[model samples]
Target: MIDCTRAMETNDAPATIAVPQDDALRALLAAIVDCSDDAIVSKTLDGVITSWNRGAEALFGYAAAEAVGQHIYLIIPDDHRAEEDEVLARLRRGERIDHFETVRQTKDGRRIPISLTVSPVRNAAGRIIGASKVARDITERQQSEALRARLAAIVDFSDDAIVSKTLDGVITSWNRGAERLFGYTAAEAVGRHIFLIIPADRRAEEIEVLARLGRGERIEHFDTIRQAKNGHHVAVSLTVSPIKDSRGHIIGASKVARDITERKRAEETLRRAHEELEERVRERTAELSRMNASLRQEIAERLRVEAERTQLLTRLVLAQEEERRRIARDLHDQLGQQLTALRLTLEMLNAQSADQTDVRVQIETLQELARQLDQDVAFRVGELRPVDFEERGLRAVLTDYVRKWSKHSGIPVRLHATPSTGERFTSEVETMLYRLAQEALNNIVKHARAECADVVLERSPEYLSLIVEDNGIGFDLSSVGSIGGGVGLLGMRERAALVGADLQIESTPGRGTTVIVRVPAHAAATRIP
Candidate 1:
C-alpha cells in the first residue's frame, strides 16, 4: 500500500531497474479494484475518464474498451450532470466527497441509486491532478430504510399497544399507544421492566412469554389480564413475536396488545343471558309436558263416557224393540182371537135369524165391524219390528216393512228391490237398515201430502244402495236444521253411522224428497258378486 501511494505521489518517472516492482504493485492494485463489486474509476478535473476497472464495466453494463477514454458524463444522468460538474470543481480544489448519495444512469439508460466516495488523485509531484471515484448501488439499503420508517410510523400511530422488550425482560421501546393504554409516557416505560404493566399474578406468564420468544416462537391472540398504571385491571389480547438481529439471532421480543375488556364483559353478559333463557325454556317445556298429560287424561275420560253412553243407548233401543215385540205378540194373540170369536158369534146369530130380515142385516153389520177390527190389529202388529228380521236378513225385513208402511200411510209405493242371495249382515247392521227404512216411511206419511213414493234397493259388486224417493210436499233442506229438524233426519243419520253407511237427503220445496243410504262393500255387505 505504501509503495502504491508513493508511486502516485512521485514527481519523477520510474527508472528501468524499478519497472518490475512497479508493474507488480500496479497489477496487485488493479486486481483489487477489478475484484470489487462497486464501480471504481478515475477521471480528470474536466470529467474525462482517465482509467476504468472491470467493476465499472460490470456496474454500467459496458466493457473496459468501450468505457475507457470516454467522458464521465456517459454514466452521469442528465439531471445529475450539474452535480457531477460540482464534484469535479470540488476535486480541483483538492476537496474529497465522501458517501455522496445520488442517481446515476447505466449503459442501457437505466437509472439506479448510488453512493459515491470521491477522493483527490495526485501525481508524483504531490499536486492534485484528478479524482478517484467509488460508487456503490444502494437500492436495497434505501428500500429497507423506507420500509422501516413506514413500519415505525404505523406502530406509533396504531391504536394497539406495540412494544419491544429485551430478552432480560427490560422494555426497550414503547409506542404512543402504550402510553395511552397504560397511562404512562414512553420515556417512563421504555427503561422499565415488562412487569410494570404485567400484574404481579401474571409475572409467571411473562416469563413464559419471554422463554417462548427466545425459542423463536410467535404467540398470537393470547388472552390475559394486564394492569394499567392507574392500578386498574384490563383484559387484553396479546400477539408477541421474536425480534431478530441482522445475524438472524433472537435478540428481543415485540408485543402488540389490544384492549378487550369491553368485549370480555359483553361475552360474560351474553353467557348469563343465554343461561337464563335456557332455564326459562326448560321450565316452559316442563309446564307444557304437564299440560299435555292432563289433556290426554281428559280426552281418555271423555272417550270412556262416550262409550258408556253409546252402550246405554244401544241397550235402550234394544229394550224398546223388545217391548214392541212383546206388545205386538200380545195384540196378535189376544185381540186377534177375541175379534175372530166375535165374528164367529155374529155369523151364528145371523144364521139363526134368517127368517127376520132386519135382524140378519144388523148381525151382518156387526160381522163386518169385527172383520175390520181384526185387520187393524194385524196391521198394528206388523207396524212393530219384524220378528223374522234376524232370520230373514235386511232385504226380506225391509220388503215386508215398506209394504206395511205404504198401506198404513195410505200412500202407493213403488219398491224396486234387489233379489237376496241368502247372505246376512251383522244384527246391528240389519237393525240399522230396517229402522232407517221404517223412519223414512214414517216421515213420508207425516210430511208428504203426495200420492206415491219409490223405494229402490239396488245391489252392486261394490255397494248396496237404498233410495226412498217420495213425490211429496218436500221441505227446503237449508231450513231443515233451523226449522226444528222435525223430519227425523238426525235419527236417520245416527242409524246410518252405526253401520258405517252414507245417508244423503235431498229435498226442495214443492219437489220430491229422496233418502239415499249407501253401504260400502267393506262396511256391511256380507256377500260379494
Candidate 2:
C-alpha cells in the first residue's frame, strides 16, 4: 500500500520539477547506441526520419541534422518500396519484426543485402507513435558464401578428379570426380591414407612430392602413374597446390588429376606397331640379302652343280604340278568314264527289269550314286583351282573362300570386298592374298576364341588393303618376334613382301586382334607395260 502511494505521488509531480541530467543521459544513450553494430534510426509513422545514430548516419551517407527531416525511404531501394509499406503498417500496429532480411540501397547507389528489425515506440501513456529500425549489412558475407558454394559444387561434380590430402599423406577430401577417376567412393577414400591407392613402386615418387611441398613448392601438371581399384596402372596428369590454414601455414595439398590411361595406351600401341614394322622390314631386307648371297655362292662354287640344282628345283616344282594335274585328269577321265558307264548300265537294267521291282530299286540306287560321284568330282576340281577369280571376279573368289572357311571352322565369318574391275593383277598376287586369308583363318580357328571374324578387302586406286579382325583373345605382336618367326605368320609375311606388301598385326591382351595387309596394287599388276 505504501509503494502504491509513492508511485502515485511521483506520477502526480509537475513536468517543471524534472531536473536537467543532460550529460549523464547523453552518455548513457551514447553507450547504448555504440553497443549495436547495425544502423539504428527513429522515424515518424509518415516515413520522416526523427533521429539518427552514428551507424545510421554512416550507413546512409548523411549527418543527423541533414537526415532527420528526410524520408526514411531514402535508404530503401526503389524496388523494395512495396515491402516498406507492409513494414510500416506492421510497425504502426505496435508490432515488431526481428531479423527480416532484404536488400537496401547504399549511398553510392549500390545494392546491399541486410537484415532489418523494426519496432514501434510509445510515449509515457503507452500510445504507439514513431518507429525505430535496426539494419545490418550482410552483402559481403552473403556474396562470399554463395561464391564458395558454387565453386564447391563444381568440384564435387567435375569429371577430372579433385582431391585434398593432409601433409601426413592422409586423404582429407574426395569429390565425385575422384570417385570416377579412381574407381573409389567418397566413403571409401576420405580419412584414408593417400598411399593406399599408390603402387608400392611409386611410393618413392610420392615422398619426393611431399618433400617439395614441404619446401613451399607447388607441383603442376606432373604426369605420373597411379593404380586403380582393380590394381591396373593408369597414367594421370596431376596438379598439386598447397592448401593454407587460417594462420597461412601450408598444411595440406589440393590435387586435380585427370586419368590419361586410354590416351597413353593408344600412343604406346602406335609406337609398338611402328617398331614392329621397322623390325619386320629389317628382317625382310636381311632375308633378301641372304637369298641373293646364296644365289651368288651357288653361281661360283659349282657351275655344273648349279645346272643340276636348277634341274632338281624344276623337277620338284613340276612334280607338285604334275601330281595335281594327274589327280584332276583321273577324276575327270577315269572316274568320269566309269560314272557314265554305270549310269548307262543302270538305265539299261531299269528298262529290262521293268517287271522286277527289286532290280529296279538296285538300278535306281546305282544311278543316284553315279550322280553324287560326278558332283563330288566337280567340287574337288573347283576347290583345286577357284577359276572364279578369272570368270566371276576376285570378289566372288574371296566370298567363296570366306564361306568355305566359316563352314570348316564353325566360326561365323563376314566378308566385305571392294571391286577393282579391269585392274589386271598377277596370278601370284591372287594366290598370295588367298593363302594369307587361309592361314589367318586357320590360326583364328586353332587359337583364337572368337565368335565372329571379319575379312575386308578394299582395292583403292593406289593400295589394296586387307583387314582381318576378330573379337578373340589377343596376343602381343611384339612377343611374336621373340617367339622367333612363327611358321604360319612367317609364311604370311613372306608372301606379302614377295608381292610388295606390308603386313601388320595389332593386339592387346583383353581387347581383340586385327591383322592389316596393305599392298601396292601397281607393283603386283601382271600387265606387260
Q: Clash totals for all models, in order?
A: 3, 0
Q: For model 2, what is the error of residue 182's alpha carbon versus the real structure, in angstroms, after optimal superposition?
A: 1.9
For model 2, residues 90-195, the per-residue Cα lDDT tens digits are 8777777877899887777877788777777766566667777777777888989999999999999899999999989999999998888788999999999998
- Native-referenced Cα lDDT, model 2: 0.76
Give the RMSD in angstroms, all C-alphas superposed, for model 1. Answer: 11.5
Give me the runs in candidate 2 sitting further than 4 Å from their true place.
1-22, 31-38, 85-99, 107-109, 117-130, 273-529
What TM-score would each prediction reach against the true structure? 0.56, 0.44
lDDT of 1 by residue, 266-312 (tens): 99999999999999999999999999999999999998987887777
Model 1, 85: alpha-carbon shift in Å?
1.3
TM-score of 1: 0.56
